[model samples]
Target: MSTPHCLRSSWHAAPANGGRRENGRVNDFDPTAYLPDDLLERIRERAPRHDRENTFPEADLDELRDAGYLAILVPAELGGAGLGLAEASALQQRLAGAAPATALAINMHLVWTGVAKVLSDRGVDALRFVQEGAVAGDVFGFGISEAGNDLVLFGSGTDAAPQADGGYAFTGTKIFTSLAPVWTQLGLHGLDTTSPDGPKMVYAFVPRSEESAGRIVTRDDWDTLGMRGTQSRTTELHCAVAPPERVARRIDPGPNPDPLVFGIFSVFELLLASVYTGIARRALDLAVAAAAKRTSKRTGKPYSQDPDIRWRIAGMALAYDALPPQLDALARDVDGLADHGTRWFSLLSGMKHRAVTAAKTIVDDAVLVAGGSSYFASNELGRLYRDVLAGLFHPSDPESAHSTVATAWLGPLED
Candidate 1:
């Protein structure tokens, strides 16, 4: 599939900007060089099948692992591509353009590695094992979201009780646990109210092993409206334990300035934005292609020549063009350790909000531009329309993003 003209101009313009210096030389990074068109086409071909079956994309994962896509954020010395968040964002956009479910599922793994990269770059080695594990081909799953847990990262519904061995045993349920079947390690957080220091948020990693037997129960209930290949099942933890070495952090509950908090927030929000932006890019391309091919019954000419079709496509392009630069700039800031202080939360959430809303708008317009044929489930635009809705459910949702930005500007409602 050809990329939309507007996207190709900005997306691939920075080919050498996000690579790491290796052996006293900098490696030039181009997302297509890593993803390649053929690999993406294969993933795309499997996407509809996985979505139809509502099953996890196992083949897609194997192919991605073979392509070294799992370790994109790991250092080259650790046998990875040694790319930064900027590069990772670009790669995700490309991958999502082909297979959103595959890209979204993989985004969870990338989030852990991205967080590790963010923290390690700032001299904190608490998550160095994550980077090494990624290079060693161990998939890390994100186990954070909980039903009705609005505190999200600031607090948790799960319990993290301290053990005598300096470990912590987590007991609770984690919803939307992506990579449910394949993750070798799960990164999660829980509340530890029994600690001497009062209620603290405990961040840790639990490996999938005999120790986790009967402790971790993955419920086979991932039926969803779209992005079915993610298989983000609900995980029930019955005293799942994280060894001392796996306990990465402990911070006070409800909004803390800890580096781990910043790292998680930055990587998660930016990566989520990248994925949705990719959906928008794909929708825009489909609309453009549809317009050029379909003839207008009234005018006896291609829809692309119709003023109304042109206007709609132009609006989609205008919205789509704003996201790449924003993603690149914020991702580069994180990589460069450019601190925005408390403003970082607002900025990250706002970007995510804009990307998701714009994606939905673009997809809605694309559906209109593609005409009646796109209404069928078999059409790619139809699939994209459903897939794009998942964006509204991700972190920094419309309500949260608005509240965050409001507080950032209006000073917390005089509370």
Candidate 2:
């Protein structure tokens, strides 16, 4: 399939020398340049401290912002790297390998920018502010997840009261609000049941700076078993207002095929899958290192020489290898606007499911390969073991993924 005309403007592809246009200036597009080895080492060194103290990785965020990592998805004309979702996925995987919590937290911000990119490429410019905001160093928070609202994206439990000035006053609690401490703008959705066209699902962004005080509250209730650095605290909205210009979409609720809905799901799932895939890569690397270092007392040789140990590592590698290709392909599909129709949901969700489940399994085996020492709190593997579990809780979870895929394959179970 041919790529979209908008994407052909050098936003999705770079020259053979890896030169990309950033604000009309030619620059290298090397992933390592954006996230250098030294930077990743610094982030990796801080992961344990953040996890132990249950604190957010403020330094990581600062370094990432300084490196222009946050603007990777925005167009070059907007002073960003002008990369595609496929490139963004690869970068997220690399970032996650160094610090999963930081990657997960930043994922929320990227989701908004990514969705904007997706929409803009398709000629829907409603979310152009998201792209421009990202370029301007604005941090975005994902506030779509609400407590017990399983019909995500399709429905909202929060109330989006329409104001006379074409704005929305949102009132509800949003859970798992990542980047809670630093988000400058929050992209969220709520139900507007009292409008003339009642039952519209409203998508909007509320200012999170001091300018919008008292209307929004961020709860410091982020203590969790893993992914602690995400600081995904709960947020309370006391009629928080999204100004007229900030109101992005107000579509009919429940399974509608809106561009906003598709953009969010596609970007969110693909980037999410990328993070877990990175975790699996990290786990696999750790296992390989451990195997080569540990000696088998029975054979007086390194564990790497042991048949069973080698087999276990091979299994992990096999599982880890399958995900990146799928991520790259699907991400390219989204970037190129290849048609997938209704199957897009199933494919996206399935990719996320495969990534998380494989990451968990790979991490589990990694701990085993590293032996009892890995069980210690100081061991990185121990931290990873805890961090990988957070994947099960994200959207398109095991049950939901299976259900979506099953329904796509089998006609919605006679309903």
Candidate 3:
């Protein structure tokens, strides 16, 4: 009945999620304004409709901007709260605890924060695009995933061919461009072949409205079964990319060698686990609540009185409390990330694999406990069940993440 002590930390509330700092680092953040109870309530009110129509939660988007969550990842010195990915991951878990749609939609804003980290100072224009979204009351989501692309690799069929003025023109398709429909500003994360310097995978932060037409960036509609409210659309960015000076890293067509950036992958994995954890928690909550009232047809006993049902409930609760120490350990290690090696990648990946898998098990237990109630659309647990099922395949399939982590751990010793 009470909130978990691990999550009851002073952080994970407003502005503590990932607010940026004044100089654009975490030190510059103001966490108080961002994590009020009111914002969570606002997000919940829109979940059902957002799911039913498969539309972006525009109202909630407005609320997020007003709360300054768009810059939550920015440091306090940078005129934003400087919440790091570790904190953001926790924030996401809490948000997902309330509504998967809300958490999923907010990812776009977070990835833009990724661009901010990757770019450092070279991304002034990109940073402006993100800030402008805050000003305009919209959050930018990325269109990076393609349906056919393997989950393990950063695959892109889209290309940014050269333009005469020194900027490259991006052409080709990108899928699962989540948050594009609601984002006023957009960025297509891809490899551009036309850079004045050389080929590279750079983020092109451009506008989404008709005003940016001849300048490039187009969107195609998307409809999906789970996280339907995210509006993950297809986008065609057939426009000039940022000049070399305005861009971040040039495209690495092959695997990135640097392990520090691997932390981003860990952050993503943690965020998804957070989302799945929240969904599983809600599902279990509903199941436990429903079990109290529903009587079994066979024995005319309350569902809660059934031995099997009680066991399932206990299992789900165990999962909810199981992984915090692991996740928290990962969070603390982030402060000393500069000292991390390949071992960091292995540990983080393993943690993600474990946490997500546990969340999946909780979902299974939730469905078994709820029985028929989980099948109804009106039931939040039902929506959550679908969302949890989707998580098993999210980011990378469970098999790949496991193998990848396992190989990372053993590959060095053998070599």
Candidate 4:
């Protein structure tokens, strides 16, 4: 497959580096730049339409894909820049700050791609799925959360079994599959339901053409107050699993997961933290901007100067400043872990819990500052509010995650 000429010449994914334009012309990327200001401005412009129309941020995703943002964490050996989890998490934070739903919806690709990159180290074909999607400009989203199964490690899940012919089929129902509407491939997680105790690996690759996975389904009436654009819906699967190459089983820490996986996961959590924080930051930014421009009815001054507003702003700022260092600490711990699991799992759980709470508090402050305007659908604060609220629901719900943490610290939830 030939690479696009536009990508070669007249295009730059980030202004940090001058690159060839889409017309196949070479340019120098500036080392000082992080993201092109034009790109940020463009995302902000599109955010309103996406928030109002309750539509997927197709334009933002397209730009992200074209700029190779989807492949940032992919290893250089596998045709990716090979950024670690810290960088990946920070990028997510920036994206979330601009548009919460858009950022959350797109992150499924990052998580799955990162997982695939790990699996790909075993062989090129194992990870070919990831590279193919990035090159094709298609972002793979997860349909992983099954209410029926209720297994805490993930959302709803079922199982896939190897067929008589050595291929497999996925037969399970999944719920809360955010971004299922636009996903090119489904990172459908399931237990090997065929197993008596469901003790086998069952990640299936189900194409979108399956009739059951029709463009959208509202079964179980999953209506989230926030993240309405996610269209996080439920679906039943009776699809054939394409056998490309055998992937590894994801075991619990007792079996001692690879340090690389543990390390990467530590980074992944921080990324999640950053993403929600970004939503909070954007909410605060909008609220402050709104407050600054509003004239008080009683005084001829900007309402942003009001004492209560100042307090809220201060709270938001504190959250903004505090989360990064916490995340960075976690990243360093994971990076330096000579022994994975049973050694660092407790600390990882603690950081995960702390980060999630800190981010939620930040969003709460931003919402408080915005007042009625934050509730208005026309306002960016409202959209950020919804996105941040939805953030609380995934990567393991707060309650279950809390239980997991306790079990790790004190030993055994069942006990």
Candidate 5:
């Protein structure tokens, strides 16, 4: 499908800042080289429009696809950049700075690709097809989050009824499904209590095709307080079938030690943290710029000279600087196969929780530094204030992270 007319205009209107490559390939495996300042500026220009219109950043997606971003984690042998999680996390942080919603929506796709990369690095070839599919321009969406299933990946309310052919039919509603309008495959999990294995959780990819007629429905109800451009809508799966070939993994439910689970949690939480960290970085930058530009009546000088503004900006910077290095270290650990064991979960969840909380706090301080002008809905800081709230709603929430940490420190509560 072609990009919308509004996005097309914005694309053409953007100055030719030499961001596009002459060969149309991003093989360097470096985000700094791939996502240049000019490209980010173009994306930043389109972000407000998408947010205001409550639509997906189709233009940004088109540009990113052209630049081979979708296949960043795919192996170089598979015609991709062959970058690792550390690099991917850095790239996500940069992307989020330009447009948080766009970066977030695309995070769903990257999660699958990152997991495939993680598994492949660990000598698991199960998800090789995911890398291949992404190289072939197939967009993957995450469909694991379900309403009222606070158990997270430990349990599923969706039914995974086994088929005679060894596949399974999934019937359940998936909430907050990002890239609903354009996803070609959805990675989801459901419980199969009737299975001979005695209650297995089936993780599979359901293809979008004519065969899914009336079986898959994407709702048009994504109006929200912020991150409106994500267009994460509710998806109804009425007996959505996953052929045997698409079935990725099947394991006993309820927190068994599974690599698939670890892959998902680690990549999801780290990448999610990366995005919010980027948002915080952007908020800090904006606050700095605003303070340097706005003159104060009392001092007849830039607010940046004011001790209060300087202190707030310094605080924001201090909070922001700590995240990227932490993200880098953990991502490197995953890439290096450093065995953290169960502590990996606590570390991942804690990093995500801290990143989101810090990002929100930084944005709040940013708006204060930006003054009353940022209170307007059109102001980027105002929009960021809203977007940061969505961080609290993601998995491994504040309560969950704290519980995990507490359990790690003191062990699980008495039965």
Candidate 6:
């Protein structure tokens, strides 16, 4: 297919070296430089097409992989850019501004790579293979969510039967498995009650292979209101095998405050927040542009002159301004190894919930500012409205986030 005019213009202006690192070490790499305007514009142009077709953003993924984004978090010694979480959060926000579903789907891969970086920084080298794998062209997908498992990371519905070969066979159903179409490896956890250790939660990565037929089933049912390009489908694991070397960690069930748990939560929530914050930023910018260009028939002047329009844009900005710094600070803290103890969960979850809520509100206001034009399905704002809704379904949901914050403030309810 021919490139759209909007994308063609960007393609003509793209720089020769947009996303690659000049030196071997990119410790001081700028996040804004991670994705060029041309690349982002291309991703933006493709978003609606994928949304309309209800298909995965394979093109977007290909472009991102070509840009070496999947290896952004791997250490310099491990053949990666070696950038930190703060940098990655910035890049994610930028990516989300162009294509929310693309950003979200890629966030799954980033979460695992980010977790590997977090673990390596904290002296836990178990997930170093994740970084190495990414550099080696392996894509990781998060497969942690399950049906009726409110305990989240602290609990599991999958059964992990130990094998004499030191591997474990996972049997369970994982829902909302993003990157379903192209993930090379899936990071998941299950409970092994029959083990000698007695009921340990086993975390491992299962490689995707056609040779292992009937083990991993990726359902083609991913129809949704927004972020359709994510293709996050239901996955059924019929004794899916993870070799002994792929077993990342095993911890006691029920709130066992392990580093692996902390790393996953911190990276996942912060990166998730970054994506929504980017959405909010894009919505706010669109509102500004629409207001400046649109004219009100009554006044014969641009809507930018209208007091109501001005106030609405200001309100959107007010909500949007607080998130980036908060994300940066918290991400920096994680990179710096600052210890927040139990407060970390509350902070991470609260930030994610707030970003999602704020992005939704900003998108709503943007649609209002754009008038009825944005109401049409072809409008970017309309697509953003749908894409932002998926944030509510992610972990650290509104109710759970509030409960976590409340518990942090008042302590858990008496037994």
* Candidate 3, 206-302: lDDT as tens digits: 5555555665544556666778877777776666354543343344654554221342465565566667666766777777887897899999999
Best by lDDT: 2
Q: What TM-score should be assigned to candidate 1?
A: 0.93
Give the poorly placed runs of model 2, Cα more than 4 Å off. 1-29
Clashes of 6: 0
**Alpha-carbon RMSD, candidate 6:** 9.6
Residue pairs clashing in model 5 are: none
Ranked by lDDT from best down, the candidates are 2, 1, 6, 5, 3, 4
My TM-score estimates for the predictions, one after another, are 0.93, 0.93, 0.80, 0.77, 0.92, 0.93
Q: Which stretches of candidate 1 lie over 4 Å from their true place?
A: 1-28
Q: lDDT value for candidate 2?
A: 0.87
Query: Worst 10-residue stretch by lDDT in candidate 1?
Result: 1-10
Q: What RMSD does each model have against the real structure?
A: 6.8, 5.3, 7.5, 9.6, 10.0, 9.6
Worst 10 residues of 2 by lDDT: 1-10
Per-residue accuracy of model 6 over 283-353 as CA lDDT, tens digit each: 99999999999999999999999999999999999999999989988898778666665577788888998
lDDT tens string, model 2, 1-415? 0011111222233334344332211245467878999999999999999999999999999999999989998888889888888888988999999999999999999999999987777667899898889888899999999888888887888999999999999999999999999999999999999988788999999998676798999999999989999999999998999999999999887776667777888899999999999999999999999999999888899999999999999999999999988998899888876777557778888999899999999999999999999999999999999999999998887888887877777756673
Among residues 3 or more apart in sequence or in different chains, the pairs in candidate 6 whose N, CA or C atoms overlap within 3 Å are: none
Error of 2 at 86 (Å): 0.4
What TM value does model 4 have? Answer: 0.77
Model 4 lDDT tens row, 1-415: 0001011111101222332112111144231133456776787788777666666677777777767787876656656656555556666777777666667777777777756543343232344666666656666766556664444333225656666655556667777676766676676655554545545555556556555344333354445666655566676666546354423344331222332233234444555666776776676677688778877778777878888778878877776787766665555433222233342444554555566667677766766766676777777766665666665555545665566566555766362
What does candidate 1 score in Cα RMSD to the true structure? 6.8
Number of backbone clashes in candidate 4: 17
